[model samples]
Target: MNKIFEESNQVALIVNEFGRFDVDSHIMNQTALSVSMLQGCICCDLQDDLVMQLHQLSKQEVQHVVIEATGIANPIELLSACQDPIISNVYEAPLVITIVDSKRLLQNENTEATETLMDDQIRASHRLILNKIDLLNSDEARQEVIQYVSQLAPYSQIDLAIYGEVKESVKHGQATIDKVNLSTSHPHTHYEVLSYDFTHPISHEQLVQFILNMPDSILRMKGYVQFREFPNEIYLLQYSGGLPALESMGDMKLPTTVVLIGEKLDKPALKNKLELLQFG
Candidate 1:
């Protein structure tokens, strides 16, 4: 993202389930990240939104535009949006970047369906950043993943990154992605999604305990809330893959609604757990 803005003020629409706040901390300049015009269930045409956003930017003489889709988004669908004739006329070819978690891919729990989905995603990348390589214990293990990815994306440049921070810019020289039959409707259908808006301050200690005891089925959660102890400040909560991290959003007034994405969620039970943290 930093690399693109340095060259020009062109736009990059970052589409995440929870919005830019999901990645805002990782970006140095929040202004560069634009909220996606649409989200969740790509059954609708994202291409239209891309065209409209591009036309608006082009009026300002913006030369190029790129898209940053969430981890679970279909790469081929996103690429199609960028190649729409209205956008293609103004910007250069789309760059598809796939960021893979090295440690997670080798885990024993991945289902065959997950593996097949990942293969499609990797093939769509012009540049593959094998992120979290630091999580791998040895150079041999790292090399094993590189070789595995090379087989999947023979045309992509494989690069290493730590915590998703690359030492240099990521450039995908590929002009377009080969369209995959993989459905853009793919990511959300199987997951259970639930959200709750807290009207009062939450107990921090209880919230911490809830996070620690969270089941693996809870895939991702993000929101902002005020703690009873802090009173005046709000914190951003990002929970993923059984880990939770809280950072100060610092009295930035926003909704205290938390959204959870998981499979087979027990909504009643989960709500009971969350109620313990909220003001009684």
Candidate 2:
């Protein structure tokens, strides 16, 4: 969800499966005030509570509402909740957009439980956006994936997205939660989650290229970027899948910082690259 709409200022209803602490990682990427974290399964355990939250949000001055569910929560159930009489009266019919990471799906990168749920999501989706098709080696491979995913989501309207640029029903990364406390111990057995603060301004073109040609291993990145082009202003930079977006923040200034989450990341090497962007 953050991968697609992290930069938006709209209200977000982020559903969590555990405690409030589970939300710590995502805090850095979002405006805490605009986000309402519901700590439980929105589809099952806390259906009533989810309804209440939606009702409250609808009454407010919010324009759009984004509901992000846990990976295990099925979209069908969530969509069902959106149809609650109270909610439907105020909110428009929710657009259940499913984002498929074609590379990860084809490579079988997910564990069995996650894999099964993801397939089910594709099978029961409305608008399916297949992201990261550019990661495939050739156009033929990408086409095969489109064909395969289309079969699973026969009723779904499919769109080919490189960054998801063109849009998640099923996502595997922690880009949504990049503000994790990086303990000496690997917080995640396979993923290296960490942050770096830019001590100097980097050229806009250089930073843009860095994101465009970012390593495949770096799953997600978010932070403030101070570029030579916009030296007087601060821009927020967010990267996920292959999409990297830079949005201006007017005169608001914070230390140009970056938080990255991914599997098999070399922290030192990443730090070095950012340094080059800043110092060079």
Q: Return the top candidate by TM-score.
A: 1
- Poorly placed runs, candidate 1 (over 4 Å): 1-8, 12-33, 42-47, 167-187
Where does candidate 1 have its weakest 10-residue lDDT segment?
A: 18-27
Assess the local accuracy of residue 235 in candidate 1 as a C-alpha lDDT between 0 and 100. 84
Instruction: Tell me the tens digit of each residue's lDDT in model 2 across 22-70.
Output: 3323334554334445344566667677888888888777767766664
Q: Write one digit per residue (lDDT tens) for candidate 1, span 1-280.
A: 6766766666555444533234343333565645554345332335566567666776764445555555556677766666677767776666777888778777766545556667778877788888878878998898888888877767677778986787543333333456333455455555566787788899999998888888766767877878999999888888754557788877676778787876678999999888778855
Q: In candidate 2, how many Å is residue 7 off?
A: 11
- Candidate 2 regions exceeding 4 Å error are 1-33, 167-280
Residue 178 Cα positional deviation in candidate 1, in Å, after optimal superposition:
4.9
Q: Rate the local accuracy (lDDT) of all candidates.
A: 0.68, 0.64
